[model samples]
Target: MGKLGDMANKAKEMAKGHPEQADKGVEGAERMVDERTGDKYDAQTDKAADAARRSYGSNSTTDR
Candidate 1:
């Protein structure tokens, strides 16, 4: 597999057991993007974060 595919597989494995950390990772990445872009893409970022949350968030969380 390609590097990206391998990385994705690793991330999937990591998230399988530690969903909260996966959620935090998504939030951190969103924050970094927002910071770099000076929040100009807040709308898009928010939407993406929501999708990520649904995918990675714990079942107990509202977003999930």
Candidate 2:
């Protein structure tokens, strides 16, 4: 597999039983993006974060 595919495989393995961490990571990314854009796209970022959490099998909700 290519490097991108390998990295995706590793992330899937890591998120297997650690979805909360994955959700946290997604939330952090969302927050960074929000800050960078001055919170102008809060809804869009939140939706994107939720989508990412779903992809990682994360049921944990972000408090941010």
Candidate 3:
């Protein structure tokens, strides 16, 4: 697999073992993005949050 695929697999394994940590990481990433973009990309942030939650096998905190 390529580098991106390898990274994706590693993240999946991490989420499977520690969902809460993954969720926190996702939240942190979202915050960083928001700060960098001045909250102009709310949709993208929400989408990322949902993807994070899904990766960890948890329901998305952000309502679609």
Candidate 4:
């Protein structure tokens, strides 16, 4: 596999072991993007974070 694929697989494996932290990481990224865009991309950031949480098999938290 290529480097990107390898990295993705590694992330998936890590998330499986630490789903909560994985979800937090996604939430942090979403917040960073939203803040950087001055809330202009809040909707898209939320959608992406939700998708990432599902992919990581993690429960969503009330952090918004």
- The models' CA-based lDDT, in order, is 0.76, 0.84, 0.82, 0.84
lDDT of predicted model 3 = 0.82
lDDT of 3 by residue, 1-64 (tens): 9999999999898887887777778888998998999999989898878876886697548443
Candidate 4 per-residue C-alpha lDDT over 1-64 given as tens digits, one digit per residue, 9 for 90 to 100: 9999999999989998998888778878888898899999888888888888888787775456
Q: Give the TM-score of candidate 2.
A: 0.78
lDDT by residue for model 1 (1-64), tens? 9999999778777786798788777788888998999999978887887776666545533332
> Model 4, 48: alpha-carbon shift in Å?
0.2
Model 4, stretches more than 4 Å misplaced?
61-63
**Residue-wise lDDT of candidate 2 within 1-64, one digit each (tens)?**
9999999989878986698777778878999999999999999999988887777687777775
> Model 3, stretches more than 4 Å misplaced?
60-64
lDDT of 4: 0.84
| TM-score quality measure for candidate 1 | 0.69
Candidate 2 wrong stretches, greater than 4 Å: none
RMSD of 3: 2.3
The local distance difference test score of model 2 is 0.84
Model 4 clashing-pair count: 0
**Ranking of all candidate structures by their TM-score, best first:** 4, 3, 2, 1
